[model samples]
Target: MENYKIPGHLRLETRRWAKKILEEYTLESHHFRMLVKTCEAWDRSEQAREALAADGLTVVDRYGTPKAHPCVGIERDSRTAFFRGLRELALDVDAPEVPRPPRTRDYGSRR
Candidate 1:
């Protein structure tokens, strides 16, 4: 029930946990749309800023556009915002953990 807030930077700690949280909470149509818009804006802003500032050695395509990097998805500003949004709006639930096998020691060893 708070005002629309976007984080200044990505929260690295929340990256993995974000997916779990999102899976638990289902947002209403209105809120979901707003979050999508915010994420899209952030994705554009980050890509544009970094692409313009890159060195000549930076890779590009035949069209001269910046080459897609795998880290981009992990490092995007939108990803951070989305994670933060997930933490704020999603419900928290403890996963049902499975039991681990017990360790056993052999008392009798072959002589």
Candidate 2:
């Protein structure tokens, strides 16, 4: 099996996504779904860098102090090497398996 190497920035982005919706933010399901889809499209680590560049954002994957695009203008008193640590941790978490709903079986007996 091939080793899946996720880019640090992508892991940071995943953290950003989690922060945006997890708990405090409480992002709506629709918005979360969209984010999930977007993440799926840019699943590769290298893709994270490209995606950020395409969006005019510069991200440095530091262990504790991941930086977003400069345009965001967010200040920080402290920094860590872990880029989006929460998100990176979340990536390993198991997602709930959603089983497909049963298909409608037409019963002619009612007719």
Candidate 3:
């Protein structure tokens, strides 16, 4: 996949949304492409914001899931690992989203 760049200083959630676009667009082309269009509309045209807001969408990530770039577990030296074999850089989409399952884990007889 080609490295598509976007502003990195935006809030984590918004960057996450854009990260979603960069990561999944190849697999889920239609769905993600539409979301990309929505993102473009939100970014490019002023009027589309009103329409999106009217339809209950925000320019930022709809789900306010906190995320970290390059993440916590990825080894700092693994070249083939994501983050393009480098540490935290502004325009790298290499960090995959770490999976955080909801609070559904059973503590098993908390006493």
By TM-score, the best candidate is 1
Rank the models by TM-score, top first. Answer: 1, 3, 2
Task: Give TM-scores for every candidate, taking all chains together and pairing residue i with residue i.
Answer: 0.31, 0.24, 0.24
Per-residue lDDT of 26-71 in model 3, one digit per residue for the tens?
5344434444444443333333334444644323344875443232
Candidate 3: segments with Cα more than 4 A from true spot: 27-111
Model 1 misplacement above 4 A: 1-21, 55-111
Q: How many times do residue backbones clash in model 2?
A: 9
lDDT of 2 by residue, 20-89 (tens): 5454443445545444544544444344445555765655666765567653332121112123433433
How many Å off is the CA of 85 in candidate 1? 8.2
Sorted by lDDT (best first), the order is 1, 2, 3
Error of 3 at 89 (Å): 27
- lDDT per residue as tens, model 1, 21-105: 3455555656645555545545555565575456332467789987755445434665577567645443454443865456567
Query: What is the lDDT, from 0 to 100, of the residue 94 in candidate 2?
Result: 58
**Highest lDDT scorer:** 1
- Residue 97 deviation, candidate 1, in Å? 36
